[model samples]
Target: MSAPSPAQADTPRSTGFLLLFALANAGGVIGYLPLLSILLPARIDAIAGDARLDLFTITVIAGAAAASLSNIAFGWLSDRSGGRRRWVAFGLALTAAAYAAVALATTPVAIVLAIVAFQIAINALLAPFLAIMADEIPDSQKGVAGGLLAFAAPVASAFSAMLVLSPFTDTTRLLLIPAAAALCVLPMLRTKPRLLAIQTVEKTLSPPRELAIAWGSRLLIQISGAVLSLYSFYYFQSLGTRPDLAARVAQVLTIAYVLALPIAVLSGRVSDRIGRRKPFLLAAAFTAALGLTGMAATRDFGMAALCFGLFQIGSAVFLALHSAFATQLLPNPQHRGRDLGLLNLTNTLPSLLGPLLAWTLATPQDFGAVMLVLAALAICGGLVILFIRED
Candidate 1:
């Protein structure tokens, strides 16, 4: 979107608009994440069998490479065009088509191509949406907005997994539901963008050192959390359970997320009401570290889920606050799309790294090493947050 004029920047949005935006975001999350987190790996294993890891590795590598390029390119395009709504609509349409192709593909090559396409489409949707937040949401409500965005993930995860994994074993429904559900948010995509009032703050970026620390802190914690979730099914199997038990892992994580939602949303509301972000962010980081430590120390499924739930609660808090905080730190209000795209790398690039880290540190025989590594990274993420000056 074009740089908001000073008047546009000061305009206020209604609560209804923000709620719709959050729901729109949830549509995207529901569309992609279940496929990414659960089904794709299973599908890859089905196709590649013994070579699933090798092929899955290749798929992730290719998809991440595509995502990194497409995210920035699309953000630049949206900025140049001075519009985001059309791009978002187009992305949803394209992703629906891609999901259909994925469902129909019998060959590994075709499936990988479909996945790459889906990644590009999803990122196209995401980058512009985030830019919209920077353009429209006032600073006073950013934490609330961020909490809404954060709230979508778990709600979507639980709903989508139960719908796809439990009720139907057919591939068509698995793919088609995401395609259809994505359109649920299309109503929110009105022709015009609503602008938000700005709070008193510099429009320019924070100091380079502060920005770097803030960015790095999120990067480290996200890598750890993403890896933990991405391979959770495998992590379940490693505990010596039956193979069928893998499907139940999503349900377990769903429970964790369900438990985490209140804590995340309430923490965010409290932060916004009190005009503080750093303390909550730091608390989340340290709490995540403690939870990860417990996850590493236990092998029992019940105990592991409890620990993982604790981690999820902390992660939910951190992610919401971090996004709100990061937007405030953007270097150029004129380039919010481009800048947020770069910052979003901290989200996508971790998907690429998490697998490699898992491969190196966690073997089938021993998953604790990866958990410990994540714990340490989370601690580091917390420490770095100490360096950023919010005021």
Candidate 2:
């Protein structure tokens, strides 16, 4: 894959717009931190006050579920609509509106509605944004795209940490998440990318068995590595830290993200050139399992932080290769959006369930159980790959 000409690459690869687009995606994490810090606390307070489950929890779960389902639907919609810029712009607009709604919460029910709005709107942007990356970047350089996307995590961490210290109390202004996202995206909106006539996309007939193995491997590692669902920061809070646990997590995950970015870029390019996904996938799962297992067992902040880095290493490896694998597995070019959307749900589902399972298994210093479960899930996901027929 040689580089395209400047005239050919003329689709406005402006550094500011490209970086802003990347940052827009990462900004979601900042908005999401409140789920751990504020939303859960609010619900717990409501529960304690009422001696019953609050409407807030139900609203959140329901909203999340709806949002996830719509993620697939919208992804499918984007693919069917021809990967056009207009459709993606629609998604971004929806996302901005949803985030704005989230900043307007006056009641738990309202908060739930706001989040649900955000979730649906955000995915509208996420799905199409990814598809555009697939459509635009030369396959050879997808590694850079993967790295940039992965970079979003650290950038998000940096922003989320800043939010913790911010002085705004208005839902809209409390954290500058809305403002940050707006600033990042404003440039892109003003200077849009040109679209070609919807071309028939190149797609795989069936994901190669090896790539499936890779996806399977990723599924498990993600499940295992996903411990910070509902109770994570609060769990840290219960540990009697005087400062906010959410704030601490933001700091730690930010560092982990920064470390993961360059690695993701390198791994993505290597996989593209080599054209094999299994070895990296296998290494990712194994390392992730190690990281999660370490995090589950450790009490010290530094140790936990180190484990975060290790786990992120595995995740970055898998994600960097994700596009390479996706292009390998898809049996239908037409269904790429739907298939990828469903695949993404693997991440969302774990977030939805990991915390719930942790809640049930909550006990004194026994967070190790979550890691064990995560490991098993990852291992099984890897095993599933062994059965996939290669492209």
Candidate 3:
């Protein structure tokens, strides 16, 4: 490799600090659309009456599928656009339109359609926003950026805390998020950078077998994590903690995520310093599994809250490092978005099945088996880091 010019040296990877800030704010809004996780499920619960569980499950599947597929497709399209700005604009516009339509949705079908629209919009925005970070961010700062990205969950959760923005009366939250995301992308649209031409030096990334293993681990971890993310509010409700309790649980989970960021950043830096990835991943995963497992066994809300914090610790570590690790192991940089899309699909698509799994393992009184399964998946994902090649 030749010495880079000052201009070239100045480019921050997608995982860099500024883009990370943009993503933290933008994704914070989009991810925490108050209605989706809490109010929307409650809405389904009311509509389904006796069949609330089954009907809510359907909504989960539909939303997840829409979000997942759109994520990949939009990412691919952004690659073709040769820039992230256009796709972000398209996504924000779609989300804003969908949010506006949600107020008018009176029936289950209408609600589902509106939510699907929002899901599509979110996926579109997420794909390019994340891809840009991956493309521009250098590995040195990746962990900190990843830590910021991990903070997005808490940020979204906190943003959605305004009870005034409940599903019944407030679609204003939706309006704000999409609008913010659009505005955030506006600056990038005007002065997009030109990619420097270089010789395409072929590098063999992870072999097919290793790639398969990595994907398998990703799928399992996401499926496990999705159960909690998709249905935590419902689960808390199942435990006899009504609406207020459910909200508190959500808040606690959000706090857990917030607490994990610094820990994840520190772990990531240690990983880089030691020139190893698997060790930190392994340690974090086990900690998460223990926390998740505790959630299954604990009946006290406080204990459950502690367990949530453990989950945060593990998830933060993985989030900070996973993209960096996966990107390095991929077969080619040219197809980074597509490959990352595949990895992301594990996160988004599994929610389609997450609810069903939750339903099967936990009803009104039981949650042990389901939580255990999720914890197991977290552990498994960490182990996959061991199988990947570093050099």
lDDT by residue for model 1 over 186-274, one digit each (tens)? 86776256554443444545766766678899999998877876777777777876755645777887888777777877887898889
lDDT of candidate 2 over 211-252, digit per residue (tens): 455555555655554455444554454444644665677677
RMSD of 1: 2.5
**Judged by TM-score, which candidate is best?**
1
Candidate 2 has its poorest 10 consecutive residues by lDDT at 1-10
User: How many residue pairs clash in each candidate at the backbone level?
Assistant: 2, 9, 7
Clashing pairs in 3: 12-136, 13-136, 13-137, 14-133, 14-136, 14-137, 15-133
From the highest lDDT down, the ranking of the candidates is 1, 3, 2
> lDDT per model, in order?
0.78, 0.60, 0.67
lDDT of 3: 0.67
